[model samples]
Target: MTLNASLLKQGAACGQEGVPPPPLLLSLLDSSHHILCVSHVSPDGDAVGSLLALGSILRAQGKRPTLALQDEVTSEFQFMPGAEKIIGPAEVAHSYDLIVCLDTSSIDRIGTVYIPEIHNQIPLVVIDHHVTNTLFGTDNWVDTGCAATCQMLVRLADALGVPLSEEIAFSLLTGLVTDTLCFRTANTDTNVLQAALRLVNAGASLEFVVRNTLDSRSLGLVRLWGVGLANVQMEEGIIWATLNAESRQRSGVEPHQSDGLANFLVTVREADISATFAQRFANNGQELIECSFRAKPGFNVSQVAYSFGGGGHPPAAGCTVSGSLQEVSARVVAALRELRRQSVDGDSG
Candidate 1:
């Protein structure tokens, strides 16, 4: 169980000298025979991509690896190589030699797949790239400076001596591309581009991954966007939209289909922060508001999300709050405005 103290990128000095040494990450994988790999619920591309790529890497070592996700993979990501192999919570095994959590920030992010009462006894390794990571695993490899966890895995494969195969290359490249929004994110550094290039050289099609991920969207999502944008609100540099049950029903879209709205709203030139509030119903039939937030480079929404029991990077974050869509949206928008005010004040000072 080792924790990397800093970033781990190929060709750059990681400067990570933590207790138990960094090589133990590989040792954990090598010593384990049967492994369980899981990612966050409502997995984005990075989550699904990292899960599949890790399975391929483990299989290369002749180890049996099972990939599990709390929810089903979206239609757009179903085309990813080996995506059909991903299992749901019910299909997960009772035991495994080791558990690898990828692209997940905390234990709860793995959702119902991890029953802490029994599974806590087993060794756990967390591989993620988020500033808000709780470092819940026995072995935590959190590289906040890295753009995506998939980029860190590129260096991990090099250390483990696993040559990038076509399947692995496709999966890893998709994670890199989607997380960085096809290299349009603020964190798209030289290291990120070089990693994408290496993956492309290893037989991944950049254009193909882009077309399937960033360039594609469902018609339902477009309809939902139309509903959200019709009543978009802005105040003190914070712009936001609320999607209640009526809005969703009117647009004929589900909750998951409303994801890209926040990303779209944040593009407004006058808005430094943007948010999308979607209404949801819990299993117990209680109302829950799912809040997705985005920020410009100088504004951070992660801490605000963390304050509300959610986690993500500085530019993008989210949370699930219990309240009506209007209540939650108003509260979160006020918080975002304050955050922007403080950020601007600090910069001026």
Candidate 2:
């Protein structure tokens, strides 16, 4: 059976059973020339997992795969497969025949400080699960309802008739577990659970992946969390925290060390919405703030983030704001306020 035929059958069964089946993206992969896979800046679990897993598949098919990143992978992502193979933006000179951007919603969010010599302005293949995606790719596979890009990749693998190896299954599982918050997110559907089961059956050790990704943290990261939690400010049911460069240095933490800080704010009982702003003061005298946004069901944080040049899913999304921490924080706070006010007024009407 063809890949599309297999996926269509699975999708039909899922629909009949009222399950949200993952979409297949492998059809686009078979035609890709030189593949460039990228993720968002300051990579997270899903970002790392999606890129590596997909890159592995491309290599399996004998395609020349280059995993490009805006910068080097942080210590956190060092354990993922293909981490060492990532080429920084400065080293990217060959025009990609096909660029597969994973996890990132927009081209700018791919976070490459330097542009590549993309030949023929090659077609982009965007595979993402973020609702905020702008459909920037020439060929796009976006299933906003799916839990993670890796979940989507699993379905793609099945379509391609490729058996999942332990390495591939682990990478895909890591993305699903982290993005779903260990299956805590609202979008965690029955099909997603089945995908997890399939990964486990294929040799993915869920317990190990979970323990390492979430349970392991450095002392610096723990201290940085305290800094984030301490600075947590709540206003009109919105909670936010700002971690500036000075605070990061003082806490002996790097930018990505505060990775889960925004989600931490979401646990606050009084907050319907939460965000964490990480400010990096570069030695070159330039500053940029990374904004991470999270919200409960009724709030549309993705739309709010997209307004400021960032995008993600409705429940979790982020954008990078340029300027000092203070400047960006004020702008973000104001945007959230406006969102809340608009929501409130909509309810009244």
Candidate 3:
């Protein structure tokens, strides 16, 4: 069924209340034919979930949509419906009526999937929840208040008059569950719970999502965590760990598998801030460090990340820097120390 403009307006008023639908987005979708959809590199739950759910929504609306990602979906997220259908940058065509960039803060976050030579002429639409979004799209729909981009898609689905199918509900719920760490994040407000409730009511299983995502971990990942913990260091209320290439190879865990280390470190009673520095290689074959940071409530980490040319929320953020393991870890740790000091001083002031 085509979107009923009056019904959409009423639904936005009564269902979403203060969060009205973007009329321009609606108009764009209505006019578009074939579309290209993409998310960030190193696809996370929110990235994969939002891309697949949006693809399903567009297909339900009878529009041909192509889903693309710069990185392969990790094994953990492969269970998500439509995960197998996602194409890589090599397969993306040079033409599309429109491009939908989801859950990414900047154009570079989309990685190689976005080729300026081929896609510069196409109108870009960015849908994201990051406070650090660069607004590098012809139309940007960024809602930092939303816990996840999938939540925004829930509202978009309502505006498009597309009923939430089982697949769409599952995809959306996966993003909500993982990004919020099963609703444990500080940002898990009433709106987040309400959005999750609607997805559950539509046929997504909370238990299933938790079991597959937050609860599931590989033996190698457990070993990797152990390695990280073994090298843990703390000073001045900031705790951190390093995962070098040798440690990672010995542990036999994929790079993405170590994501939760920083989150785990922040749980220490003595730490108000936490960081994890993992050695990685960039596209140019140069050594770089991927730094992930987490802050306890009332402490902001995004500013530090932004200073280092990265971006995220107040509670969590990250950046990539060029350097050896020791060099990067020392530099980032010093930065985190200053950030913690500033936070304490602000509280005192």
If both were scored by lDDT, which would come out higher, candidate 2 or candidate 3?
3
TM-score of each: 0.93, 0.87, 0.93
Q: Model 2 misses residue 141 by how many Å?
A: 1.0
lDDT of 2 by residue, 65-127 (tens): 888788677776688777898888787756666777888777778876325344336656667
Report lDDT (Cα) of residue 94, candidate 2: 61
Write down the lDDT of every candidate, Cα atoms only.
Answer: 0.84, 0.77, 0.86
Number of the top-ranking candidate, with lDDT as the measure: 3
lDDT of 1 by residue, 1-349 (tens): 3334442331122223211225556788999999999999888889989999999999999999999998899888999979999988899888899999998887888998888886888888888888788777777777776788888888788878899998998999999998888999998888889989999999999999999988898787788888889989999999998888777867666675576888888899999999999998888989998889988999889999998889898999998889888888888888998999999999999
lDDT of 3: 0.86
Per-residue lDDT of candidate 3, residues 1-349 (tens digit) = 1233443333223223335556666777889989999998788899999999999999998999999998899889998878999999899999899899999888888989899877998878778888788767776677777888898999899888999998899999999998898999998999899999999999999999999998998787888899899989999999999998878877776666677998899999999999998887766989988889999998889888888888888898888888998998898889889988988999999
- Which ten-residue region of model 1 has the weakest summed lDDT? 10-19
Candidate 3 clashes between residue pairs 3 or more apart in a chain or in different chains: none
- Residue 252, model 1, lDDT: 65
Query: Between prediction 1 and prediction 3, which has the larger lDDT?
Result: 3
